[model samples]
Target: MKCIERIKYPEFDFKEYKASEGRHSVHDYPAMLHYLLVNHLIKNYSSENSLIYDPFCGSGVSIVESLKLNRKAFGTDINPLALLIADVRASNFETDRIRDVLDRFNIEWNNLTPDIPEVKNISYWFKDYVIKDLGKIRTFLRTVKDNEIFKFLLVVFSQTVRDVSNNRKGEFKRYRLSEEKLKQFTPNVRKTFISLVEKYLKIVETDIIPFTDFKLFLQDVRVSIPIKNVDLIITSPPYGDSKTTVAYGQFSSFSFDWLKGLNPYGDGDLKLDSLCLGGKKIKEQKELPSGHLYDALKNIEKIDEKRALEVYSFFYDYYLSIKQVVKTLNDNANVCFVVGNRTVKGIRIEMDFITAEFFESFGLTLENIFVREIANKRMPLKNSPSNITGKTSNTMLNEYIVIMRN
Candidate 1:
């Protein structure tokens, strides 16, 4: 079947789309859809050595898919933990060496002493025994000589922290944990770490590992990078302010606080306060719109101007950063961004429209827009509310795949 016929507008049957054979399906996102899009670009628009890029490469999905197709890949993220995961997933490593490191990690785990000062927040979330066990594992990880293996182990440990924490598995926001429940399933940090390492090892052994050049950086998309001429760019920027739809910072705080040295109040270059929003004063700066649509939304008057400005400014900064990165691409390069609209004060701000305006400002032509239904596997029924006025409304239910070209 033709590709265009396969991608029917409004009602693409994504359930029937199976991922490429032998591709590990552990990561989130529609792998088959992303594979089809990446494959299409490679077959029609790319040369053998074309450089593919994903600025907001969550879990390294686009870069991993690109590598499987023999394309050089570049990815960056503000989250250090994310960078570590991407680096391990994208790099070539010897299985035996990985196992050796795991063995050493186990030995070190057994002999480790919890001498390091305990983080106050860590103590607050985890029981005394749980905190001590986690601290021992983290301390051992710090002493590992193999940086790649250390990072992989870190990912394993980080992923397990959520499961072991008092936080509910399905809910991504902060929640108080009952002492009884915390005592029941306090994750054995070492045991979970070993199991996760083995699982990752099995995935690496079974899946196809295509030979392609790849790089991962703990850098923000808003800044310039070393790559001069990218051929294709694929990314999904953060959904406006972190507090709105997806609390990425809060969701990943366990790892971020331990590894990235993030301040509990978010006092870093990548903090939520640093983003550009339309209504709120962020970093002491007045609310400013990056485009007309945002300005129009700000003029609604019914919406809290301060809050709306903060949200708009955050998104605007992220959009502008992505635009700057796109500018570094080759003249013939194509860029695809996955984003969704968010509502404030019952007014839906068309994020896709705002993104289109930003891209147009960079002389890029809009190629296509694909709308996908919101299937949040993690937070399936947690926040079904369409409005956030009382935290009882389901605010967002759809996303847009905005495709453009230089």
Candidate 2:
């Protein structure tokens, strides 16, 4: 295959095709890889029926797309909500079963008494009436018999949970609206849930494909390798540590908090960013394989010593995960890492070069690094990495798709 130095996706519209993506469009993920990009990568990287693996499959876009392209897939993530969304997306569902389940759920919602889970400071995020309505929906969901139908119904309700929450919309972090804004906030919780069920039912009907084998594991790739013999790896790992870049854990907290019992692997705590890659700080700094990474750390250190450590810790964990992943890849397998070069304290970290450097250290050949502008990728326009009010830095303008052969 020929390699291109850089690539542009002017024709790929993020919102271009809705029903075609099936369950992928049922929920939104922070910094999600568009369906078009995932589909294109799977088609080019692996043959039909080949095994594909995503180590950091957030919402399972790679898994869904791979199966849609007639390939088997495996996805692993530490985030319970992410795993649930991915699991629901990858599973095959019958439209008739889902409709029947929905019918029973509506009847149960009216009869069942509200069973509100004990979420820490739930009132701050939801009003009294809204809380009761959500509890009623959740209580009824617990009575569901079919596992697939239960998860599918829970996902739809989860969407409604985020939509009707006091948390400000379009922000990944848990920022509550002002008191003035709260006064005007009126959300019809029941209406929202029913409407979402109907909307996603249509998508589920369109996405019903023949049964394809796909597995989702609620395990961290950094600690354990769940599968082997991967022919292709298509994933977009967290660009930076969860706290600074995309707060995936924080973003999913609302829904996870409500559905913690259903999660087989969640720790009951909601600070998921701390458990994600680069979420922890390393006390010792050691030699790294990538010179580009070392130099970036030095540059960041000059600006802020603590900030440099944060960056170093993230990369260190990232390198460890790469090492673990290398052990699982079959010979001549391909890896596509969709990464963003984020600026911290005004120094742009060369993630693309660093990523290439890490893979090369493990005997993988760097094939190509295709740069694409962030036209519609959902991310904050700017962020204060330093946490100072005025110390703002622009987010990534583009992302690099670093393709390598193992």
Expressed as tens digits, the lDDT of each residue in 1-406 for candidate 1 is 0011112344422434454323324322211234444455455556667888888775676777788778889887665555566666676667789898777776677688863343446667766777777777767777767766666666676776665666765555556566776667656767877787787777777775576589876666666665769998877776665555555555566655455432211222225323322223445444333455656555644556665566656665766586578667999798877776665565666677667667877778777777765432222222333423223234455667777788
Which 10-residue window of candidate 2 scores lowest in summed lDDT? 385-394
* Stretches of candidate 2 exceeding 4 Å from the true structure: 1-22, 264-268, 381-394
Q: For model 2, what is the alpha-carbon lDDT of residue 151? A: 82
TM-score of model number 1: 0.81
lDDT agreement with native, every candidate: 0.61, 0.82
Candidate 1 Cα misplacement greater than 4 A, ranges = 1-13, 16-47, 115-117, 260-299, 376-395
Best by TM-score: 2
Candidate 1: residue 24 lDDT (0-100) = 29
**Residue 53 local lDDT, model 1:** 85
Residue-by-residue lDDT tens digits, candidate 2, 169-285: 766778888899999999998889988888888887777755478988887777879799999999998888877777787888898878868754454355688988999999999
